[model samples]
Target: MITLKDVCFQYSADSTVKALRHIDLTIQDGECVVLTGESGCGKTTLTRCLNGLVPSFYEGELTGGLLLDEKNLLEMPQYEISRHVGTVFQDPRSQFFTVDSTDEVAFGCENLSMSTEKINQNIQKAFHNLRIEALKDCSLFALSSGERQKLAVAAIYAMDTPVLVLDEPSANLDLETMEVLRGILQELKREGKTIIVSEHRLSYLMGVADRYVYIQDGEIKQIWTPRQAEELSKAERKALGLRSFQSISLADIAKEGAPAEQGKRIEGRGLAVRLDKTEVFRGLTFNFQWGPAGKVVGITGNNGSGKTTFAKMLCGLLKPSEGALLFDGKPAAAKERLRQTYFVMQDTDYQLFTESVRHELELAERKNHRPCDMELILERMGLSQAAERHPLSLSGGQKQRVTIAAAMASGSDILVLDEPTSGLDGRNMQRLKETILALKKQGKLIFVVTHDMEFLDGIYDEVMSFAQKIR
Candidate 1:
């Protein structure tokens, strides 16, 4: 259904630094194709080419031809190309320019001039097909990470495009949600939709993939069938740059069957938050205590259910609008909060403003009056190799760890991280888990807001969930 012939692309005017080179591939109807590559190895660029974004949205030199059916995608207008090929981006927030879930799903169909009734029908169909029927009425900001991901897929599927491309669909999903998505893909396959996914979670896609295409250094290194992928050994797979999976849990590491019960690290008595006339959350009081002096706390809920808001409140970045926040049974304010707390924002770029990774941690140390033994933290996070590199040039996992190291090195007694594992692989997730545990061992309180329950398992002493409060 789609083909790329002798395709080459460059992101800059230089034309020397090619993002993709001489790429040749084909995707038949109903085929489930998996694209694998290291960070910055052109997986995203190649996929962007399929939708005519290479020379359109991205400024680059393009050579050779890409054909979707009989027409060359390189020559077609981007809008025309999108009609046949739908893309779901790595970050769902990037695709959301609408308010509610239903409007978001129907937005694309409406633009295509589909009838109102037809658009509505497709919206409902998409909702039911993805098992997110209840989410149709929710605001886009109110959905969970998993729900947003499902909605993004639903929106793309509603377009009824013949070719669907997803960039790392399982990046932020917990194991259970990942399985649901895999089932959805299987159903989509049965409907004969051509699907191409760029994923680092090979374990999740292991048996589901019909074909594996590995890209390295802007070129296709190998293309293999499912059987071929299965035959490869662990070392051989790593050599092919495939990321591995871990079934080990924190329980296994601690050799404890169950986590200890949490007591009360931070207690908010009758706390409430209001924005203007609207109450975000009211009369909601909770207590977080150390299960052990060194254990993690995982806080998660439906998106916009105030996870970030609550994180900010906990870290003193946002005031409670109403109540008193207590730390260890004492009243807390900015000065006290700063001495004990540090928050890692969801987007690390928002917090990262340093030239090199080393300097980034150094700045955090200076600001917090903490020790500057950043090398030890870097080594713990497996970021020593990229210690001197520009923070922006590092991969998502590397950048996340750099932010984490900065937070840890700040010498705060409490650390609040928002979606720290959003874009990490299994190996990197394990590494991050180890780092968190190390911090926990030091009697530092770790509060994480994430959808990655695999990492949360056995780590969290308490799991706090929030639901939208009704008036």
Candidate 2:
């Protein structure tokens, strides 16, 4: 069992901002509890506390009693605590230290001085459980975000820890991969492991989670059993900024109308892209049309299916090895495409260069001489109150919103957002749809590279899918 008695924490002793406050909770052995809340509400911070990363790795000021069984967790070393708890972080890239999948999975066992034969056995079992046998020799750098996330979980699984804590494990996964994840979680539960998940996507956990805990501003606001969660209506869930409690089907969410064929077309002919001698795609031919005003186009596929590569080519960030791109009837030049296109990256941190949210949007507007109302844009993106806060200090979802606001202020005719809904809550996802629709009405062609079925269903006018092998 795990217990916290009046636990409170802050990153620095002098800093006034607190990450968690007066957190009182308990979990029985073999219970699966989910931590659900809005972005920046301390769900991640609480998970860090459970794994001994709060004060140990983060150098935070902590007060209160944290115990696992009879052992005082607050007094134990991080390495000692790792023997019982295994953590899978929100960003898989942050925890990876190996070049290949096989080595990565065996790293923890080696550190614990496990026998070579035992290490190999654990590796094989983990690979089989996650259905990633073919990825044993794959390079970690070459793997897609979703694949990397799976590998991260597999690595922790090989450790055979009694407690597992996962932070947003399904954020980067597609619909099919999400189902696979659910099966893995169910198997873990069957084995009598204590599981704690911090997630914004709640649908997949409905079947596996025994209880739900909601937090707000570093405090526990509510707790519910599975039976209670099922009783809440869709409106109530939305009002609380929580995602749906039931699974959503992509086929069910698809719009009724057939895709529009007549519009201003951006054509790609014989397109082939090669990165560092690795062919990502070849002989890809397609055309995307935007009507007189605009349209929302969704790009969907399994991870590593060249979605990001295609989006990069469209925004002129990467040049194709062989092909021709035409905007309307004219051949599109790299410089001209760069001038008219804005690409919001999947990793929002990579695209955010400004110190503050307001400054970021102001800089984008200044670049194009299209001055937008900074306050109005910030209000729309729900960053008005965080205008002066450092972009790096904001939550993952907030950073994504800031990047999108910058794109809107860029005054570009074409915008491509990569996984814009990755870390958003239900309310913010709806707000993003509204923002995209508003941009479409202003005659801007929009392309969203995403795996979010709910967001796609709500806004996309057309859907384009990529395959593993290009024909």
Candidate 3:
């Protein structure tokens, strides 16, 4: 069993700010507990405490008892604590060290000095359990974000640790891949491993979680059993900034794109991209239009199906090898497209370059012919409290929103957001939708590259898919 008693932690970077406050919780040997909360509400910090990374990896002032089977986890060495707990981080890229999929899976077991044959067996078993055998022996860099997440889970699964912690494991997964993840979690729970998950997308955890622990502003707000979670009305969940309690599938989301009323149009004729001598997509003839109450088109496809590549192409980050893009019936070159488009990348770390979030938005605002409401944008994106903080110093979700606020300030006609809601809570997702709609009124054309079904509901004006395979 794992227990946290009166645990309070303040990061060394922000001495006056406590990341976690009075966190008291317990997990039985085989319980599956989910940490649910708004963005930056201390869920991730608490998970770090359980894994012995609070003071070890993150440098923080920690006070309180964190015990695993009556042994103080805070006193244990990181390597020793890792044996009992295997963690799959929010961003799978952070935890990966190997290039090959099979090798990555074997890395944890190899660290235990297990025999070569046994390690190989464990690797194979993990891949098979996750139904990711097709990903075996593939290059990690070549895989999609969701595929990399699958491999990350497989790597930890091979360890067979008593305590398993998965942070937003399904954040980037497609509809089909998410079902696969759900099955794996259910199987792991049946095997009696104590599981803790920190998530913004709660629909995927419905049947698998034994308890839902709601956290707010660095404190535990409420703890609910599965039945209680089910009993809560949709409005109640919304009031708490929680996502859906029921399961969601592709059919539950909007799949058709809405026709815009008299707006700018982007036409693509026989557009194709070739990377490393491989065609990502081809024979792509399409026209997309957006107008006031600006349309946010959600892009959905299987892992490695060229969603990000397409987003890059639309935003002028990459040029099409064949044919061209026309804006409002005029052929637009890469340079012109570059001038008209702004992209919020999937990895916010690559896009955030400012010392402070406020300064980031201010710099972007200066680029626009007209200025934006910086304070209002900050409030809508839920970054008002962290406006003066460095973009890199914020939580993953906060970083995601900061990039978006910068995009909003850029005053670009076409905006491409790749997985913007991956780390966003329901309330903030709603806020972003409102912001996008508000931008839509200014004649902005937005394309959102994502597979988040819950986020797709009641927001996006259309749904676009490159779901078919291309050589």
Which candidate ranks first by TM-score, i.e. highest? Answer: 3
Instruction: Order the numbered candidates by TM-score, best leading.
Output: 3, 2, 1
* Per-model TM-score versus the true fold: 0.80, 0.95, 0.96
For model 2, what is the C-alpha lDDT against the true structure?
0.87
List CA RMSD, all candidates: 4.4, 2.0, 1.8
Worst 10 residues of 3 by lDDT: 254-263
Task: Summarize candidate 1's per-residue lDDT along 1-471 as a digit string, tens digits.
Answer: 788889988776435467888999988878999988765578878888887778887787889878888787777887788788898987788888798988899988887788988898889889887777778777765565567887888899898887889998876655555767788788788888899998877667765679989888789989989888777887786566566544332334343323544654688887787655446776768776665466577776554466776787888776777778898788999667766788987766788898898988888887668685777888887788778878876555567888888997888878999988766654566677788888888787788987555667656666676645221
What ranking emerges by lDDT with the best candidate at the front? 2, 3, 1
**lDDT (tens digit, per residue) of candidate 3 on 186-271:** 99889998999999888778899999999998999999998999899989988998888776655777456576667678899999
For every model shown, the clashing-pair count is 4, 0, 2
Instruction: Pull out the clashing pairs in model 1.
Output: 264-289, 265-288, 265-289, 294-440
Query: What are the per-residue Cα lDDT tens digits for candidate 2 across 233-323?
Result: 9888888888887777667787675466577889899999887768988888877777767888889888778899889999888899998
Scanning candidate 1 in windows of ten residues, the lowest lDDT window is: 248-257
The segments of candidate 1 whose C-alpha lies over 4 angstroms from its true place after superposition are 13-17, 142-146, 174-176, 202-207, 227-264, 268-293, 300-309, 319-324, 352-366, 371-402, 456-471
